[model samples]
Target: MTETPETAETPFDRAAEFDRQVRTLVDRGYPSLAGVGPEAFAAAVAPLRDRATATTGPCDIDGGRIPFLLVVARGAAPIEETMPRTTLHRGRLPGFVDRSFEPGSLERFVVPEEIGLPDGDIYLLLDVERGEEFCGVVPGEAMKTVAERKRTPLTIEEGVALVTHFPEVLAKNKCFSLGGSRCGDRRVPALWISKRAPKLGWCWEGNPHTWLGMASAGGRSAG
Candidate 1:
């Protein structure tokens, strides 16, 4: 009998793939992800692996419109010319504790502290940008102060990167390249609905990968 390679056995070129996806998004008119409802948000998320099983819940707050989830192709790479610190460092997000998130309540979309929530929350996982910066909140675990690589969900920066790099004053819903001057790609935020992995850690899920802004996501607006 011959042994076959596992489906995931082959490593993917995450960075290259991410760049490709961004390019595609640019060609597609940069649709806005701001006002989508639960059903629509559900459709945005990337599905879990066939063998994998997990529940997803929607973050359908703000009446019906969806919030933004920013992403970048290269999050973990050190600050450089092509990729600048302004993007890796500056840029605004919504909030740490979701506005709709109740105190002491736990949900996949809610922060991972002060409460435990029931199942069925959608946490989108982008296929590209494996090493980009981002994170996720476990169902009911105490959020560790620091990430332990693969185990923690996403760093605030990675998630911010996904956000259309925008200035604090501008509240329009669009996905601008972190370094728009260089990338010259600006579109509505790329939408990816996410689900909670019961027993899994951040690394295993493979979200935006970066150590920036790991201390606490409360630095600026992270809503």
Candidate 2:
């Protein structure tokens, strides 16, 4: 007996096909995310997914006034329409936005002063299928540092790999953690790690002994 490909498709197959189609479209120069691979692409897209999956309320900054810029794939109308407006503004991804935003459109929001805009236009990540993605809002002065940390058009795997390989680098230099998590049904854990000061002779101030212990344990585990 020969195994035959069934016409009936499972959700997994459909999802895989969707991923492949998205990958192909992205690789062919869709803009918002021009230079990333499948993994980084997936990671970048996660934020959008997270927004879509959110059941209680939309994600907000500055008490619902500031909009979270979302970089989504072109022609992704259903996904866009489904996303919570309170949490995100459906902006075209870097390469895709050139034609999307018109002058004086409310959809476009200036990068906040506190966040520090990059010398060039900032970009966001959109992962429609999985409901997970990230936002990259680096300031002008930090562009070089951000560039050193992650390559353009990153993939989900690459993003994770980067966070894993340079955990301390990101923690100390970036002033934030790699992933986000919800807490106690009300607040989100905005975990940020502090950079080590050159003259302080300590990593996290008041946590020197703990840091040393962890380091020693880590070394032992690695060995």
Candidate 3:
């Protein structure tokens, strides 16, 4: 079968790529979580729509062409609520919080002061990488590697956003850790395929799981 130009994969098909992202979010009910309807939420993202790009290939530690991810800030849509919306194989997985954390534990896992994030209810995460290489490395060692490469690790919200927008990226045996957000402790939050569904769980920082890597991005921009 011959592939038409529209059907063929391109690195930068601006309009089609951006529209697909908008549809993905709307389908996953991100607009409702942001206190807006699908149309309003998409309109809010229109100003930055032209800047959207697709992840055509792999990203390296030094940086590469990573896709731009549309993120609803944690403040706007809490992880607990957004997580359950995540789906895999038509099944919804609960966003399980580690029992070690208190009831309000998520609030304590704020974006580090050093990482200056965009100020808004919604924004664009540039050069987002799934951190496949860091899979076998411990969270502690992965942090050093991420820092050495001049990249910021992803927070819990960003992790949810990544999986929400790109479900195929959260494959079994290739889930990732949200090492960016921490509560001054060693517990690192992660998203993995649990019981054939996507789950938000945590792992110890010093421990290395062969299936988990640390997710990161180059930086963030206001949407």
Instruction: Judging by TM-score against the true structure, name the best candidate.
Output: 3
lDDT of 1 by residue, 113-139 (tens): 432211233222321122212223221
Q: Candidate 1 has what TM-score?
A: 0.21
How well does candidate 2 match the true structure, expressed as C-alpha RMSD?
Answer: 19.2
Q: lDDT by residue for model 2 over 71-121, one digit each (tens)?
A: 332223211221211111122221111122234331222222323212221
How many clashing pairs per prediction, in order? 40, 27, 0
- Candidate 3: the clashing residue pairs are none
lDDT of each: 0.24, 0.24, 0.75
Candidate 1, residue 173: how far the Cα is off, in Å: 19
> For candidate 3, lDDT tens digit of each residue in 1-223?
0111232353345456567778888887888888899889988988777556433333221322246778888777888788887776445564454455678888988877888688888888878888878888989999889989999999888888777766667876778898888888888988888767787778999999999988888887774
**What TM-score does model 2 achieve against the real structure?**
0.19
lDDT, model 2, position 103: 46
Give the range of the ten consecutive residues with the poorest summed lDDT in model 2.
214-223
Best by lDDT: 3
TM-score of 3: 0.85
